[model samples]
Target: MRFERVWWGALSLLAASPAWAADGYSVLGDWPVKATSESGIEAGLKGNLSYDVARFGGADGGAFADDDAWRRQELSAFVRKPGMFELALGYDFRNEVWLDNFVRISGAAGDLRIGQFKTPVGYEESAVSTTATTFMERALPVTAFYAGRRLGADWTYEKIPNWYLNAAVQAGGDLLGDNRGRTLGARAVFNPVKDENQVLHLGLSASNEKRDDDSLRLQVRPEAFLAARRLVDTGALNRVEGIARYGVEAIWQRGPLLLQSEYLRIGVDRDGVADYSADGYYLAASWVLTGEKRGYKSAAFGNLKPRRDWGAVELAARYSHIDLDDAGVALGGRQRDWTFGANWYLGQHFRLQFNYVWAEARRRGTGLDPQIAQLRAQIYF
Candidate 1:
């Protein structure tokens, strides 16, 4: 009922709003009002909304037969000045209402940012924005191991050509409260080849976290957009003291073809119990049928652009696997997923995506295979 209301409300708002301009944003709709003082202070408003729907089948039971939801991914405003110092505040209307705020300072050497932002851990998790992902949802491995938004301070150094470094220290909970834990993470990326026609990126990332009184749980869905039930869940492990995660990623692009892969390992330490570890990896490839190559910046892939009046079309496929059973725990099940996706870029701010997923999982001597199909309509300003 509430989800339906929000979904319809977002649709109504989008329909009532003015159309977007060629540059992909309307001065009146996107940057409705912007002002610059003589001292170089500037301010503006920004927001985006996304809606997702899904149908599930082939499961032992009707786990996720049908589901849908609308999310106000980002509704925020920002203020900035000449020295590249800025402040931003927003709310994320996902499953829960939460505040998203941050500050940034830039100088000759590097940039320092403090805010509630996504942690830098995996290539795909850090690179692709939610509004512009190739698939309806991220891979299962990424969802299981990667840390989402956290209140933290991060530093980035990219003054050296073709080299980038990022480091951060963050609280594991949201601004409203904190009960999860604290984390420290770092990443380094080097681009040996960068050009208009080709790009190659190699990166490594690691994180260390101190758990808060055995409250950590690891789980993931079957790469479905609207399904809420996780096929694999480690239900709250006991006496968890700490966790460490490591990842390696690579991306290669030539012309309109792109290939990417990443591997992640997470180790958990417990009190009076044998330590255990879990790992996962994924491989994906995409091709732009409209001859518009995906853009690469700051070690991540940006959104696709339409090259013709008909718009841009992209086809993508992925294979992902995650194994959570280790020396002491067997509850977290193991899963393998194969997904095929298509994306259509009507313009810079409007996109439609479709995905079909086949997932297989084994737990406690039982096996289940599920199939899911999902669609998404996204609009942003």
Candidate 2:
């Protein structure tokens, strides 16, 4: 409680800063701590803190402990010369993992980056920022079946108009030294109708990974972080040596309205056993109530900028489903969820989000359905 009190005090001061009212206040360009040198190098320090103020009913009945909404607390430091080169380091106080400590070099050949970065898959799973997602938590599908961050080398090319390509090779493990696997991944995107007010985009991604130990466990909450137990779970499946994942994504944005969808399928290859498969998908839509459009940059979606200094408001809905039962492997079972969300952006550095999830999961002839409500307070820079 004392730590939370101190954090809240700090947030109050940031909320009163005059800098957040500037027209240049941007999710990527503006920082709470920024400076520039005569040599034309820029440096910045940024961070975010998000937590659930309260949770009610639903899956979080204090059944499994940890019924708090302490989502994330992260800080990042970066130095760059315009866009030609940049170095960044990020750390998560809550998860105890290195986020994006990487070096990036840009040229006519596109961009090359090496370090701990995202693996270039799953759109909603990789929202530009933790605080920028349309909902307080990511959809169930993305959470259940995606390789999040990894230590790796990646290359990207966007010289061709309306086209983007990314290739990456990952080894070692995540910054936490878990899931030590060798993975090769690639993604391609085509944005045909790109303009100020209208856009259409399609993307495909695939990855193949081999682990030192052939085992995997898949589980996820019911679209609520404060939920005590994961509704669907595959305790542990061993014998598999490799995994292959394929995904397809699409997005259409028109003014203040945006529609997006994604599908992910995975194949688990086991030793002396039949391969098993799993799949999941989600559909999401959002409408900005204050005439602001969601930001899009570098093949990713970002937060919306308010046309007025008063800030922006958005309404969103998502339907997500995941099926982990394949062949005789029915450990995780199937889950379907419907989530309705509302977000209020209070200037550049703060926002408030609320979500209600209706979820149902069936496993081993047993079914669980819960209606949950949660609210989150966020501060980021």
Candidate 3:
């Protein structure tokens, strides 16, 4: 990406801003480079590193099976014209997935984004930043229905207070060069109440998709990305033609406690078979024990910032279920999960997390259960 060339003269520019200068920065420390040109242009780097280790147990035979990995290693650099627009290039080294490589324009017409970025299909998927997800991973429905990252364009409108609208079109393939499908999505959000100590967000979304091939696979890793296989899998729907996705999400925060939920459904049109359908939903609540609240903006919850030098501590729990059985599609099965988690935000940019999950999956009357515990050390800037 010739990133070095982009920052070749960063030292001189950054040195001009004595107020913005920091002692050190990087994945391991502070944000090293942040500078503004004399003409009001801003340039800087962004990165997020998440390292995970897990232990699997229970009667599922997954016991004694353990794995560790660099869950995500992503870095990006951006140059922006304050209040006007910005250009950013990013990539995830661990998954070899492209992050935000796009051109964003801001003005009276609202935000018009082009290039590779996330599609505004679901509330959690579109609004919540990956670095700030409530848990190690999102709920089942979100993971299965949301279009990750695609080569396309997205438009967002928020000219009216407390109301947001977004629509996007995607073609070709995903960032990883997979899911070669054409997609279109739209979402609308309304914040009935927003104040210093309370906020309520309501949202609805819908999407249509068509893949290059007639075969489609829908699977989800059991709330633990480190797992090698998906316990509930719909191998490959051989006669699929088109797909439709829909979702409803809501979030309410009062003081240090937050409540959130989402329901997502997907429908498939098969050639010789009846239309198939699946749905999933989750309910979660979190409380910040250190008297800190997560910030809210752009229709999403921002990462929590520590108020104390020792940082912030949070406790959360969630229950989720996904049903992939419908229209004679029996083998896809269904899964129900319960997860308890704790997060310790050491600073604005570093965090430690732990999660315990109990997953129950069934297909054609047979069941599989597993207990998993995982930990993550993450840093972001």
Candidate 4:
């Protein structure tokens, strides 16, 4: 019911608005709501909302076990001055928590970022935004191994030609006061071939995390939005001391086609038991049917832009795999997912996405295969 209301509301908004091409890269343009002063201070509203619906078949138990919901993804506002600094504070409706509340200062050398933000990890985990991803959700390996937002400070240096480097130290937890531990992470990317019509990007990342106690769990959904259940979960392994994670990423883009792949490995150190390890990887490809080339910036791919009045069309496919069973632990399970997606970019602020997913999970010598179909309506300003 909630999903239906939000879905309708988004459609209504799209229908009521005039079909005007967005100005440059700003979706809202210079609206009356924004203010700019002589001192270079600028303030405006920023928010993104998405409603997702999904149907699942051949699943034993999970949120996607024939269920759907409307999710309030992100809501935020920001204040900034060009080339000086910016501050943004927002909330994530999906997790019902605070979003990226951070301040960044830029200079010739690099940028200094502070407050609660995402850790420098994998390409999909930290480099890309939810609104710009090619798929409805990120790959399972990224979600399982990469650290999300945390209270921390990060430094980014992109002065090197065709290269980007970032490092950060963060507190492991959300803003709601659930302090988990601490983490240190970094990422480096180099674009060997950067051109107007083609790009080849290679990147690597690593992170070390120390947990407060033995309780640590890693899990992920089967690449389906609104799937409340994680098909693979490494339920709270006790006496865990620390964790180390590593990742490698590569992306190649030519004309309207884009290819991306990443691999992640994690090692958990237990107090008295032998260290356990898990790994996952994914490969994805996307193409713009309307011939609009996908944008790339800061070692990540941006959103698609429509050239014609009818808007832009994109088709994407991805395959991901994760293994959580190791040594004496066989409870988390191993899973593989294949997803196909189609997207319609109705201007810059609105989009319609559809995805079909096939997932197979094996645990304790038993296997379960589930198929899911999902649709999403997204709006941002």
**How much lDDT does each candidate structure score?**
0.79, 0.81, 0.82, 0.82
Q: Write the per-residue lDDT of candidate 4 for residues 104-132, one digit (tens) a residue.
A: 99999799999998777667968887788
What candidate 4 gets wrong by more than 4 Å, as runs, is 1-34, 58-64
TM-score of each: 0.88, 0.90, 0.90, 0.90
* Candidate 3 residue-wise lDDT, 1-381, digit = tens: 222322332333334434333433322224547799899999999889988878888898453368778899999999999568999999999988888899999899999889998877667777787789879988877887776778899888888999999999988877678878898989999999999999999999998888888777788878888777677778778778899989898899998999999999988888988778889999999999998998998888989887764568899999999988874664688998899999977657777788899998887788878888888877788
Candidate 3: residue 127 lDDT (0-100)? 79
Model 2: per-residue Cα lDDT over 1-381, one tens digit each: 533653465455545554644655544233548889999899998788987753445553444333455678999999998659999999989878788899999898889999988776677775357867888888787887778788899999988999889999999888888879888999999998899988898999999988877788888888887676788887788898799888899999999999999999888899887778888999999999998997777777788766654578899999999998875764678999999998877667777787888888988778778777677777788
Question: How well does candidate 1 match the true structure in TM-score terms?
Answer: 0.88
Model 1, C-alpha of 63: deviation from truth (Å): 3.3
Clashing pairs in 4: none
Q: In model 3, which regions exceed 4 Å deviation? A: 1-32, 61-64
Question: Which of the two candidates, 1 or 2, achieves a greater lDDT against the reference?
Answer: 2
Candidate 1 Cα outliers beyond 4 Å, as residue runs: 1-42, 59-61, 81-83, 97-100
Candidate 3 Cα deviation (angstroms), residue 304: 0.9
- Cα lDDT for residue 148, candidate 3: 78
The TM-score measured for candidate 2 stands at 0.90
